[model samples]
Target: MIIFGTALLAVCHLLGIFLGDLLGQALGVKTNVGGVGIAMLLLIFARIYMQRRNMLPKLTELGVEYWGALYIPVVVAMAAQQDMVSALRGGPVALLSAIAAVAVCACVIAVINRTERPQAQTDGAPILHDNPLLTEAE
Candidate 1:
């Protein structure tokens, strides 16, 4: 059950790393090119596909979801390890890229927020009602 999901996740992670390395090499960059993110995306898509095909067990899906939830925290921790001072000092290009990324993310969030419909409002007051069984005829 869970073992199958774990195996799938592991394979995706390894493949992502390999692809990232290849991408970095192709781009003449030394850093991994979004390997973890790519891995997470792959795992999510694979799980979705499996679920659609009715091939995924509940236990396996739960396992995948647990690890997927950990992805953000893990990625954040990894990013915290990067030397920001050195990266910033590297060039204006890095700073510009960061600014662009933030801008893009902000725009995407705004769009998503705008696309969502507002929930209907309601009061919590209880309604009063007369008992039908307490009529004069009774």
Candidate 2:
């Protein structure tokens, strides 16, 4: 089972790389970055879909939990990019702009949350099975 799963993952990765290369060529982007970005997006969507369908147990059975911790190193490496950090270290204008943008986003989120109506809930509800959107769709 582990061998089969590994083979399937390798195939999916190869497919992602091929598709990303084609996409990058069309968009004039570097193949390495585009391929990686595409693969990351595919993984994210797969995770979301699996979670929505309650496939966590299956993932755990496959020992996928260990692989989940691999993202920490990638995140740390991105934070270490000198050029990206330098670009953000401009004069007061850049600092103020970032602050203003964050403040605006916060205010917008707060206003939206305040104006939205709360959902109706029964006295006893199963947290896992209860979703307002799913009920409405039914």
In candidate 2, what are the lDDT values of residues 56-133, reduced to their tens digit?
A: 456442633333345436644774474357757777776787689789999999999999999987797566877799
Q: lDDT tens digits, residues 13-35, model 1?
A: 99889888988999999978988
- Provide TM-scores for the models: 0.70, 0.40
Candidate 2 off by > 4 Å? 1-12, 55-62, 71-138
Per-candidate local distance difference test = 0.85, 0.61
- lDDT (Cα) of model 1: 0.85
Indicate the residue-level lDDT of 136 in model 1: 50
lDDT of 2: 0.61
